[model samples]
Target: MIYGVVNLRREATLPLVVGNMNKQQQVIDTVIDTGFSGFLSLPSSIISALDLPWSASDIVTLGDGSETLFDLYAANVIWDGQYREIYIAESETEPLLGMALLYGHRLQIDAIEGGSVKIEAL
Candidate 1:
C-alpha cells in the first residue's frame, strides 16, 4: 500500500521518488490528476536536475481543447515498494500523477485538508 495526504488545496498529493541508473533520486510531491491519461508530468527544472534522458515528443490536448507538444523523458519511479519504469512528460505545471501510473491500483482519498490518501495494489 502507498500512503499520502490531502493538502490544503484538497489535492490528493503523493510523494514520488524519481531516479536514474546513476542513483540520482529526488522525492517530488505530485497531485493525482485523473483527467490526465499519461503516466506522469514533471517540471522542466526537476527533469534537468535529475538528468533524465530525452525520450520523444507527443501532442497532448489541454483542458481548454488546445493541443500542445510535450517532451517525453525516460524515468524510473519507486512505486508500491518496487522500482518501475515510466515516462515523464515535461510540463510547466505542478507535478501530476496521471491515470496511466495509477493503472491496476486502487486509490482512496478523504477529500479534505490533511485527510488521508491511500493507494493499494490489486
Candidate 2:
C-alpha cells in the first residue's frame, strides 16, 4: 500500500473554495484533523458567514459526543499542491481525513528526523 504523511502545521491551513449547487462557500481554515473522521469542520461562525446550504446529514464524531455544527457536503476531491482538483473523500465525516483520504492516495506518515512530520506518497 502506498502510504505517506506530511507535516501540516496549524498556521498552514489551506485556503480553498467550497460550496454546493455550484455556489462558492466561504473561505475558512481547514486543519489537518487526522485524529477525527471528518473532512473539514466549518465553525458555526464560518457557516453563518458563508450562508452554506445543507440538509440533515449523519452526525460525525468529534470524541465522546457528536458534532452539532455546520452541514457536511460531498467534497470527494480538493485542490492539489498546484491548485488542481483531486478526488479524495470516501468516508462521510465532519471536518476530518477519513480512511478514504489516507488510503485512497496510499499515503504514509512518519516522524521527521529533524523534529518534523513527513508525508510520503506511494
Candidate 3:
C-alpha cells in the first residue's frame, strides 16, 4: 500500500466549458475528485448553467444495484504541483475523488502508524 500526504481542494461548481475548443461554453462546477476517474458531476443547478451540446452517451453502474448516465468531457486540472488534462464523466452529484485515481496515484492514508505511507514525486 502506498502512503503519502496529499493536497485536497474543494472546487467550486462551475458550468462545463471547453474554452480552447472554440465551441460553445459548458459551465460546470470546479469540484474535481482527486481520485476520480475523469468525469464531471453536478447538481441540476449546475447543469442548467451550461449550454449542453448533447446528452451524455455513457452509462455508469451505481453502488445501489442501479445504473445512471454520466456526462463526459475533457478537462484541465492543476494538482500536485502539475497541470493535467483528463476526461471527466458527468454525474448529478457525487463526492470528490474516488479510489480509482487514489490507487493510480499510489496514495496511502498516513496517520500515526509506524509503517505509514509516504509519496514523493521524482
Candidate 4:
C-alpha cells in the first residue's frame, strides 16, 4: 500500500519514485487528480531535471474547455513494488497523478488538511 496526506489546499498528495532512462531516481510529491485520464502530468522543470526523453505529442482538452497540444515523455515510475513505463505529459503546473495511474488501485482520501490518504492495489 502507498500512503499519503491531504494538504492545506485539500489535495491528496502522494510520493512517487520517478526515474530516467539511465535509472537515476527521484522521489517527488504528486497530487491525485481524478479529472485527468493520463498517467501523469509534470512541469517542464521536472522534465528537464530528470532528462526525460520525448516520446510524442498529443492533443488534450483542458478543464476550461480549451484544446492544446502537449508534449509526451517516456518515464518510469515505481508502482506497487515494480518499475513500469508510463507516459508523462508536460505541463506548467504541479505534478498530477491521474486516473491512469490509479487504475487497479483503491484510493482513499480524508479530504482534510493533514488527513490520511491511502492507495492500495485492488
Q: lDDT, candidate 2, residue 27?
A: 44
Instruction: For residues 1-122, write the lDDT of model 3, one tens digit per residue.
Output: 22233223323222223321233344233433444444444444433344333434677776666777776555444334444444445565642344333344544433332333443343
Better of 1 and 2 by lDDT: 1
Instruction: Report the number of the highest-lDDT candidate.
Output: 1
Displacement of residue 19 (Cα, Å) in model 4 is 0.7
For residue 62, give model 4's deviation from the true position in Å: 1.2
Model 1 agreement with the true structure over 29-90: per-residue lDDT tens digits: 99999999999999999999999999999999987899999999999999999999999999
Give the alpha carbon lDDT tens digit for every residue of 1-122 in model 4.
Answer: 98999999989999999999899888989999999989999999899999999999999988889999999999999998899999999999999999999999999989889999999999
**Alpha-carbon runs more than 4 Å astray in model 2:** 1-12, 64-77, 81-103, 106-122
Clashing pairs for predicted structure model 1, backbone only? none
- Cα miss at 22, model 2 (Å)? 4.0
TM-score of each model, paired residue for residue: 0.97, 0.47, 0.46, 0.96
Tell me the deviation in Å of residue 46 in model 2: 1.8
Predicted candidate 2 versus true structure: per-residue lDDT over 4-81, tens digit per residue: 233334222233455544454444334345565544555455454544455446655556675644355443233343
By TM-score, the candidates rank as 1, 4, 2, 3
Q: What are the lDDT scores of the predictions, listed in order?
A: 0.95, 0.41, 0.42, 0.94
Candidate closer to the true structure by lDDT (higher is better), 1 or 3:
1
